[model samples]
Target: MSQNLYKTDAFTIEYIPGADILKGDFLRCKTSDEYVSAIRAFKEAYERVLPRYTFWDNTRFGHIITPEEQKWTDAFLNYPGAQKGITEKVGILVSQDILAMLSVYEIFEVGKAPLRPGFFANEKQAMEWLTRKETPVAPLPDTKPLIAVEWDADNAKAVIRMEMEAPDLPYYLNRFKRFLSDHDFLVENLRLFQELTRRERKILSMVINGLNNGEIAEQLFISCETVKTHRKNIMRKLGCSSYSELLRFGLFL
Candidate 1:
């Protein structure tokens, strides 16, 4: 059974008991305050429901979080004593826009990246990532210390491992390294933002927004060959050797 806990203009929060998951679907928000309010409501429901895992879909979300809002939100979500009571794994199905994503990248990447959270391109990936748990049977060949946390029967008690670094890049970028499936889907999605020139960014934006070479060329008043060259460069930067890979990566990434 599923319980629709609350619905605001910007988002919806629900408890899906069949999967024992708390789900949040963010539709859109005009401002940071509105986004925070919606998340605040979700946090309240999170305390009340206390599901096993959480999955947040931000596919339709629009607000580009400011730096101050990102810092506040990171602290607000991971408050004192909040780690133990809340669910262990969190999977966020993130926005496709690279620019919009830069904002969210800051929230999780600004601090030490805990092992519990993952960012995915779609719901199936997110849910697949969410249900995954680490079961340490024995020490591996690696020298890194492994800490296995345990919880009570009701799962009201938990010892969450924290304070580990994810990566200098957005955890989303490095998170694919931890995914058991699909090693090839790992893309340098940020390379489009990080490496591209301002003009290239404009061209790449058009490319991701579903424009063809000729169309982008016409809009930007550049030659189609120039657009093609830019697209080729972007594909190279994203580690995509083919157009299909680039298109798929751009659409979902």
Candidate 2:
């Protein structure tokens, strides 16, 4: 048995008892406020269902999110309660519109949500993938994840599709991985700085200003060897591999 859980002019959410999945079909463009409200209603329904459930999100007629809305969506995803372990898998069916598909991809790439997400071209394929009993922990053989986009001048829209075994997955993954690495580096550096001594902090400040070891020692009236030791300690504490890496961390200060 399936039941309608929520609906608006823009979207409808339904619960499928046979598949134990919450499926949402987005019907039209929505203002930021409307989008937020829809998501909140969806979240409420998700919690009412109890234990974790898989999700089917059909956005074949959806609109792209504005930059302001993207910020709001990111904040919502980062909220502690947003991830109540209520979802185990998510299948998103995207529109052919390039901008809309880009928006969907941005949600997956940048949204800080805990979800195992896959992209599909249609509802049937999405349901089949989402309902599978066991998922592979490693990549499948001979296939690659792909995100394909094409510009259609006639319609003034983009034709976009993404799949788990499309050839361009690595390119997208590499870009996202760099973002994660930089974010982690900044967070880790901030934590490590709290452990620095007064003298080390002074030395680190000078190092960040592009001072060489000897120049730092001269400025602080310390021995060159002592400056070298402090620099080494600072690098060890900050997990910086080289001077250039340390400079990158300096941006946070």
lDDT per residue (tens digit) for residues 65-112 in model 1: 887887777677754214565566666666765445556766765643
List of clashing residue pairs for candidate 1: none
The per-prediction CA RMSD against the true structure, in angstroms, equals 19.6, 10.5
lDDT of each structure?
Answer: 0.66, 0.67
What residue runs in model 2 are displaced by over 4 Å at the alpha carbon?
Answer: 77-82, 135-253
User: How would you encode candidate 2's per-residue C-alpha lDDT over 75-140 as one tens digit per residue?
Assistant: 664233345654566666756565655665566456666443666656777777777776522112
Runs in model 1 lying further than 4 Å from the true structure: 112-116, 135-253
